[model samples]
Target: MKNVEIYIKSTCSFCVKAKNLLKQNNIKFKEIFVENSTANLSKMIKRSKKTTVPQIFINKVHIGGYEDLIIFLKKNI
Candidate 1:
């Protein structure tokens, strides 16, 4: 089983898309909702260097947002 983490915002459409993609792939993931929590958002930005919602990590390595995640999945899957 692969370790997957998704840093998401509740209002982000991209986040929804990303999550749907994961569901379609039958992937299990841990989701961190960064809503009204500066500390959590800060942590995600620090780790990913990205301010976008749906920042993804697989096996603890940052894979970026939705588009990047799709590309990574295409390459790996």
Candidate 2:
């Protein structure tokens, strides 16, 4: 199993979808909510080099957002 980390916002539909996909695959993840804090948002930006909700990392590798995650799953699963 890989160590999965997801940066998400509470009300984002894509974030919900991403989490659901992971759940369906039985993949556990650490979720960092960046909806309210600038510090966390900045951290997510720095870590992912992206300004999007649902930035995902698996085993410290940046895997991008929901669409990218779906692509990764299709190729790797």
Let me know the TM-score candidate 1 reaches against the reference structure.
Answer: 0.94
Candidate 1 per-residue lDDT, tens place, 12-67, comes to 99999999999999999999988888998999999999888989999999999999
CA lDDT of each prediction against the hidden true structure: 0.92, 0.94
In the range 9-41, model 2's lDDT, one tens digit per residue, is: 999999999999999999999999998989999
Residue 33, candidate 1: alpha-carbon lDDT: 89
Residue 32 Cα positional deviation in candidate 1, in Å, after optimal superposition = 0.3
- Candidate 2 Cα misplacement greater than 4 A, ranges: none
